[model samples]
Target: MNLEKILAISGKPGLYVLKVQTRTGFVAESLTDGKKITVNLKSNVSLLSEISIYTYEGEKPLTEVMQRIAVKENKGQAISHKEDNAKLTAYFKEILPEYDEERVYPSDIKKVLNWYNTLQAKGLVTDEAPAATSTSEEIAAEEPVKKAPAKKAKAKKEE
Candidate 1:
């Protein structure tokens, strides 16, 4: 799934899809309400693609974490974010055992789950990489490859 265009603005309720780019910043439509709003450059906006969770090894990108959850849940919605902290922690541990409890708080886990559900509900979550390859392969098979022209040999220098 591509989250590059999806954003999580601080102090905002739900995720937003980036729409038109403005001179100052850009306009975005809320995934929950479908209302458009202009987000200024100074605003605390984070692309979902840029978010990451702290882990024992290092930080794991949100995309990879979401993909793990998607696979674990069979591409279905994860447990509700409203679930208790213990439950949430357990679930996240099962998915990412090395997640740093100190750095990655319960609230962060909830947000990730909630965002995943929202994205899945909007049909934005997808296993498209493989499908894209198959389509590309099909196109390649249908089209013939064009070969580059061979260069002419240069004449030998005279003694």
Candidate 2:
């Protein structure tokens, strides 16, 4: 469910995974086609983690919204975004009840649904909780293991 590297580049179809950072910009691999492309720094690239949906209470992170959709759909593909606007809006309403109807347009809903479907197809969206070992493991991540220094080899005398 990690959307940290997922990006939605404007003018680019489907989602992409951030690959490498270059001097001028960065390289991204398209999730739809598995092809890499370089994008300039001036390009409009939106990280999925940073994107949020307008809600009545406030702005809800797109990650949480996507997770909700995954739960609702049991981690399966959701309804097609190509469907009619009314049906898309209704489906979106089910996913986010407090979504601001005025601020969130049909196009936006379509994008969200489309992205969710793509992620689900790639097996990124999941409803199951992450597994943890031990009964009282309190930490979210385990500490990094330290590596031992390499031993120096003795130099052989010339014979």
Candidate 3:
């Protein structure tokens, strides 16, 4: 998937939280891959903290790595986290697209390319070129306007 599609679904990958019917009891879950980690509201689950990590093997979902890391090791305490689109964009750029004609669509790849551009513009990811700057009336108010280099001067010399 492209960065935009990822960003659109990023919110879905956080710790699931809910209150029990009593309203006094609460349940929270850290879901990684297909695993479910449950914790109580009164206490914290270090092993259950959910954070987003990026990987680009292209064979497995990012969630798979998360699950592996979760089950193999405690990963310390769980720190609730949401995916940062900018980080995801940088990751995407670092992992060049290997779209095969039979495997993926050009338009799908283009969407990712566009997403990368958007992230770069937002300063979430760094590209070779510096970010573009724009001047508006509000900005011009702060500085004196300079006349365009006088074409007449050059024209007179030519004459």
Candidate 4:
């Protein structure tokens, strides 16, 4: 479920995992194949973490959309991206009813489905919810704290 390291490089064939950082850009290993390549700043690269889909309310993060797909499919691979445009659109609609049809294209839908399948094949998709960090207040309530040693009574300066 860690999409931060996953990326879509423009003109690339499949998903890639961001690896070492370089002076100009960074090294990325193709998820389809273990091939590693250097991606420069000039190369158009997008982290899956930063991608989003247009929705009626606003933009929905790609991760959230992927999660929805996982839930709907019971953590299995989604429909093949190779499916016809109509089918893809319908499936996407079922997952995200509010998706902005005007802004979201069939190609975009295909990419999402493809990505989800790729992630699933790699065993990256999960049914369990992401672990949530407790807020400061919640943490404080859960753990008891010992009182700080009373400022050592200034040793009686009775000299």
Residue range with the least summed lDDT across 10 consecutive positions in model 4: 124-133
Model 3 superposed RMSD (Cα):
21.1
As a whole number from 0 to 100, the lDDT of residue 27 in candidate 3 is 42
Candidate 1 TM-score, C-alpha based: 0.80
Tens-digit lDDT string for candidate 3 (1-159): 112112212224433323232344344332223233333345432221222332233443333333332333243212212235455433333343432334433333343434333333343332233223556975688788988886754435544
Off by over 4 Å in 3: 1-6, 9-98, 126-159
What is the TM-score (0 to 1) of candidate 2?
A: 0.80
- Write model 1 residue lDDT over 33-149, tens digit each, in one string: 899999999999999988899999999989889999999999998999999999999999999999999998899999999999999999988975322235777888999889889
Off by over 4 Å in 1: 129-159
Candidate 1, residue 36: lDDT: 99
What is the Cα root-mean-square deviation between model 2 and the actual structure?
6.4
Error of 3 at 38 (Å): 26
Give the TM-score of each candidate: 0.80, 0.80, 0.24, 0.80
Model 2 ranges off by over 4 Å: 127-159
Q: What is the lDDT of residue 150 in candidate 1?
A: 90
Error of 2 at 14 (Å): 0.7
